[model samples]
Target chain A: MNDFVYKWRNPIFGSVSVVLFFLGWEALLTWAIPLNPFIMSKPSLIFEGLWLEMQSGQLWSDLLISGQPFIFGFGAAIVVGIFVGTMMGWRARVGYALDPLLTALYASPLVAIAPLVIIFFGVGVSGKAILIFVLCVFPFVFNTYAGVKSVDRLLVNVVRSLGGNERDIYLKVIVPSVLPFIIAGARYAIGRALVGILVGEFFAATAGIGYRIAWFSDMFELSRMFGYILVMMVVAVLFTEGIRWAERAAFPWRVGM
Target chain B: MNDTTSTAVSPVPASAAPVRDEGLGEITRRTFWEANERHALGIGFIVFVLLLWEVIPHILTLSRGMDLFFTTPTQVAMTLYNMFASGEIWPAFKFSAVAFSVGLGLSIVAALPLGVIIGRSHTMNAMLDPFITAFNATPRLVFLPIILVWFGIGMWSVVVVVFIGAVFPLLINTYAGVRNADRLLINVVRSFGASEWQINKLVILPNSMPFIIAGLRLAIGRAILGIVVAEFFGGSSEGIGVMMNDAAGKFQVDIVFAGLVIFMALSLVMVGGVKVLEARLSRWRPENVKSF
Candidate 1:
């Protein structure tokens, strides 16, 4: 009992604090601002709203709509970004040539360019996917470039000294070396991809969680809006945790995880 | 990132310098700066890409002379020049600056103390960590719709959006900074019968400066993002975002490009400032270990 308590004390206390926080908010909403759910929503009403949306079948479809851009844009970004990043990593000139453009794209608030994105790509899933791709590709490229560029020359020399060819050098050394960097880049990209969806759907997306957020809020359906917010947060948390798990599984040698 | 790399590469053993033929990390930066200031291969590559973008239309012989979504660099430059000459961008720039300042100010005020309290208290840290991580992972733009509903359409909503977006980085960094306090130092201070406030002031706050500075750097980017996105969605009429919207609505791709350039420049300036401060504050920080 003592060992168990010691081991899980933080979690227990933390759960208590979180529960207290919710109870406090519930009390404030129930007694203080009962008249105006729009001002600040209560937990009960939010769950109720969530239930209504789920029952109406609009929730699942919107979730799928939101998932599509993530699948398309983030998927494409992962595949192509790793390739470009690897190429840039292998070739010094390629890294130099692309570095300036990548720097600009990375630093610039791509959110400001949403209007231009919509204009150029015509407010479709493809357009939104493009936005997600553009927003997400930078981090992968940077981490990958950094990872590949910074590889030790001594290792390559040692491999060459041994009867290893270029293919052997790449397969034996570079791939395993840059795996962590690729994962780091993807981890960074995931958050941006989520934001890219919101930015895309906010502008003119036809059907997505972000679209519902905009539509519901415009109609003063704060509970429904907050419901979607909660759902998206769950999705985001799950995605982040999932990546973390994969990173740990892939690189058991790393310490920071 | 470039500046960081140059300094970061210095801590390596000298033995590896001659084994390899060329180190791009060393040579690229040195030559990029030393040769004609403009004739470096890096600069040449950058210029070639931009010039290629400018000439692609002519090369392709596209119909309507590249008016259909492809913009030339020279055209973007000319349009930016005209906007500057006409003094139209200044007001939008001012609005964004005001919102950014006000919002960042609010976030700093809110996040610092709360973070300290949570950091020092084990219970608070345990409970708040999950919430903080969840909110941080969730994009700040998701809050824009709710902020708009609560505050209505105006600068106020934009400011709140900025505040929400920027606060978490500061809070999380401050928490980490405080929580990672040196145990030996804390015990030594306690043995001297130091008050909690004295210990915090003498040790915790001072030790946390690097993390706080790093957090500030992260927050600046998020705040800028929030302000721009908020203005776009919050129906504000006075921001650079509004100007981009107007330009984009009319298919003025050059103006949109101009706005983008300005925003990127602003972000670079902030990042540069933070990098300078970080260098100054991080003297005790050992050179980062290279991960392989």
Candidate 2:
């Protein structure tokens, strides 16, 4: 019995806690307080609303709309950020020259520039994509730069002393060392990318999950709004977990690094 | 984020020395330039960009249209000056300041104790881990709609947003710090007949200082973003974000730029302050480990 308890501890406790929380929340709304559904929604009601929305295909369409810019922007960020970060990292002068500007950009709330982005790119997919790009790029840039900087001097020297040329050094030493940092940066970028898509859609987009969220809120469809929020939460969890799984698969030895 | 902090402050490495022989005066000049090279290059690059930003639009005849959407640094500066001179920015600034302080204060108060509890307790950690992970993973903005519904479109709603944005990072980091506290020191305290409370106060808290400070650094950025995005979404007509939003709608691009500049400055000052505190607090350690 003790062995079984220990083996199943995490799942058992996690589920019980989650179930009890939802039950308590439902009971509090239903009996203890009896608040209006329009003001505060219950979990069952949220699930029901979500089911209806899913059946109507609205949720799928919204996901598709939101996913486009997220993919484009995130993909572009990975390419450009890695290139720029590599250049900055490999060349000391390049890093010095660009350090101040990059730091300022990284430190600031990039979302505040959403309006300006919309103005230049227009209220379209391109604008939202650009916003996500700006939001997601810095983590990649900085992390990759740090990774490059952190490469072992001894390893590089070993490569050079063994008749290895620049390409050989890069392939054998630098790329392998920096791959983990790039993955770590991607993990960070996922959250920022979500924020970018939301803010972009909020600012000007005509379609997308963010637009649906705003529309539901404005119309006071509280249950549906909660439903969409749950979808967002699930999406966030899935994306994060997926990346973690990839990281583990790619670098099994560096599990906690 | 933690990685960037160390890299940002580390001194830049000087380039390889020129091998060719030269005059003594020329060599001295070259050495001086090399010593100050990073700062000079950084400042010079910024100035060049600003000049280009000021000139390119006019040269391309895009300035006329640009004024409607993009503004020059000079225009942005003038707008900032006029806003302050006319006392126009104070009310918005005051509102945001109050919300920021209150929300961040509440986050610290709530997270620190709860984090310590969860970190120290196996049962509590097991039960709460899933919930914490879920909330932390979800963008805090997703809560804004429900928050606005519950708190209405005002300071409280904005405060709640900021609190949510700032709290998770602090809580998670604090928990990590406590869990990763020096177990050897705790054992030493136990051997000395210290009670649980004494152990925590004497060893755990002090050891976790760096982690808590790193958490605060992360929280400040999230909190600032929360302030602007919350105000933007909430339609509160009395914060910097609201002011910027209003300016955008009216095509007052300069005002928007000015507001963004202020936000950037606030972020830099607050983050820089926290970095200084972190450095001071961790001075005793031989090497500061990056924690997030």
Candidate 3:
């Protein structure tokens, strides 16, 4: 019983702190603001708004809209990133050749250029997806390329000495060595991709979580906007945790995991 | 990413001539070129992009009498030049730079101590794990409206947004640095009867400098991101974002592009400046680890 209590003490305390924070927030909203309750609704009111939005299917639709671009962009990042990164890793000359452009693209703030993308692609899913792609792909590719380059030279030389062909050298020597970097990169990319989606929705789109939050903000529906922000936070947390889970599953050999 | 191979290689050039049957001078030069050549693609891409930007609008105008969708590089340059000449860009730049500095400063102050404290305590780490996860993962832009409600749509609200956004990276990095400090070294310091403050100052600070600096780099980028988002939502009267908002409203594609170019350039310069500083620090740092 003592051990159980000790183990759970911090979690309990943390939870209580969080609960108290919300309670305090509610108290401030109510008593501190003697006049306009609707302007800054209480925590209870925010919860009720969340429940209302959920019941109306508005929250679900908003989630789906926000989620679509994230899914598309993330998928594109993994596929294209892996392909290009692997190629760049295996082919030194090619990697060297493309290095400068990738660096510029990697350094460029794609969010700032989000408007240009909207101009070219229109204010739709395409623009959002492109923004996400440009933002997320760089880290993935860079990590993968680094992983490939950092592969044990001794192992490669051994394979070569054993008369291993390029295909054998790549499959047996390079891919496994670089897998961890790829996974790590992908893990980082997930958060970036989400940011991209949010940024896109903020600027260009008429739908998605970003759009909903902005819409609520514009209307000055403080409580509902707060509710949507919470929802977005939940989504981001879940997405990040899912990525970490995937990384642990795929790269069990990773020391920390 | 260029290693200090030259300094290490120069002395060996004369001595290694007969040892490897090839002069070390040749190897060093090859390494230098190989390092430098990595930048070729970036140069080529810039040229290619410039060419496209220059050619595309002219072709569109000639073929369809429409350059609405496609703006020329010349037009973008002209817009930037006009903004520069008129000194219209200064206020926005000043606002952003000031906001960025303040938020970044606040984040460093709050995060560094908190992170160090968390790093020092396992109980605190386990306790705040989920909370920190949620806090860090939360898209701060979503809070812009609420923050505006609380702080009002001014520098304070924008600064709050930037603070929230930038704090996570510094905290994470500081925690990482402290956690990763060599156990043996800590023990050695402790054996000398060092106080907590002494250990932190002499041992922990030096060991974690790289990670702390790395976190600062990430924080700066996040700071820029948060500033832009805050400006977009929180009704900021000036800054690049206001220009962006104005340009977007009027469908001034060239002006919008110009704003974007300025922003990207600013970000690149800031990030690149930090990268250079990091490189210099790493070189001067006692540890001889290779950097990427």
Candidate 4:
């Protein structure tokens, strides 16, 4: 119980501090800012907006609609990124040939050409998914490439000398070595993918968190917009923490340093 | 043995001075050509892309309107020249330039020292890791609304976004650099009765230079990306991002492409500039070259 207390102190303090920070924000809004209650929202007002949205069921419906394309696009990015990364990583000739091309594509301003994407795929699920895919794929591909490159070259030689099969080498050496990097890449990818989806919604969306934001902005409902932003932020934090926890659990070797 | 073979392919013409004493002119030419021959494939790929870009629109679409969507290099180039003539490009470029400079300068100043301080204390790194992770997890762009609230919708807002985007890489790299400094070297320096300042200046700074530069490379790329996103999202008055947004809203696909092309070129130049600086710094520490 004492040990638990010691461990929990930081988290508890962190939570309290966050609460205090928001309370301070509430206080500031109450005391400061010249605007009336309607134009600029207080924290209490935003929470009320959030409550109203929850009661009206708009939040859930928007979440479902937004989540569908996000999942599809993110899934596609992972599969394609892993496949392309593995291909480039394993074959020297392929790596030499494709590196520059991939680098250029990866470096391009995907958001700028988002309109062209919308034109090609229509301002629908496909367009947003494509945007998400383009934005999400680069870190996965690049990090996986780096991961594979950084694998123990000596281990590969040893496996070959020991007459290990291709499957054996991949299962034993390459996969394990690159796992951490892939996790890191995925962590990065999720954030980018989220941003892409949000931006896509902002530009050309019928529904989603982005749509809600735009809706609120158009209506001058600052409280509702702030609430939506906060909700999305909470979701993001949870997702990030979940992945980080899983990473730490899976890579226990990295712990107790 | 590997060093000699690799040095043979080193492209710095300045290295030719070392070869001059050995009268290896023809060999230098052969090596340079061999290296260039390898890179020729990359150049060829670029040419193929340019050709494809030019040819695909013509072959795939019959309508002139469709050409606007799938723009050719010529169309983009013409659009760029048109924008240049109209004097619309400079304001956007200047805005981005100023924003990037201020943001990157602030990031370097703030993050590097903070990283060093954090690196010096394992307890601090451990304690702050989660908080840092939480910050990193939230897309730096999300700070746009909050920054807009704090600083209003202008150049300062854009700079703040860019600074937020750039700082993580800088801080991470700096901390990593300092923490990974050779313990033996530190001990040796300490044994020599050097002051902490002397040790940090002579040992820590030099050792961390490469990592800081690596961070700077990432920072520049990220900074440009942030500037674009910030301008697009925040009420940025002028920038390539704003130009792209306006062009897209107006359905001027070619101008959008022009704005994006300029942004890409600037990003490439920034990365390349950082790389050259990194190379120059790496030259000073021959013994420190191989590991990192």
**lDDT string, candidate 4, B89-174, tens digits:** 89888988999999999999999888988888755675666556667666676556656766778999999988998998999899
The sequence of per-residue lDDT tens digits that candidate 3 reaches over residues A183-257 is 778767877887787778877677778888878877877678878888887888887788778777876777442
Best by TM-score: 2
Worst 10 residues of 1 chain B by lDDT: B1-10
Q: Please write out the lDDT profile of model 1 over residues B3-29, one tens digit for every residue.
A: 223212334678977866567565666
* Cα error, candidate 4, residue B191 (Å): 9.0
Higher-TM-score candidate among 2 and 3? 2
Error of 2 at A147 (Å): 1.2
DockQ for every model, please: 0.53, 0.51, 0.40, 0.23
Worst 10 residues of 4 chain B by lDDT: B1-10
Model 1's DockQ score? 0.53
Task: Write the number of the candidate with greater lDDT, choosing between 1 and 4.
Answer: 1
Which residue runs does candidate 4 get wrong by more than 4 Å?
A: A1-13, A27-45, A150-166, A253-257, B1-37, B81-88, B116-131, B178-207, B282-291
- Candidate 3 regions with alpha-carbon error over 4 angstroms: A1-20, A23-39, A156-172, A204-206, A255-257, B1-18, B21-25, B28-36, B58-66, B183-194, B279-284, B289-292
Residue pairs with backbone overlap in model 2: none
Q: Candidate 3: TM of chain A?
A: 0.86
- Provide chain B TM-scores across all predictions: 0.82, 0.87, 0.85, 0.83
Q: Write candidate 2's Cα lDDT for A52-123 as tens digits.
A: 999999899999999999999999999999988987787777788888988898999989989888888888
| CAPRI level of candidate 3 | acceptable
Could you say which candidate leads in DockQ? 1
> Which CAPRI category fits model 4?
acceptable
TM-scores of the models, in the order given:
0.88, 0.92, 0.86, 0.82
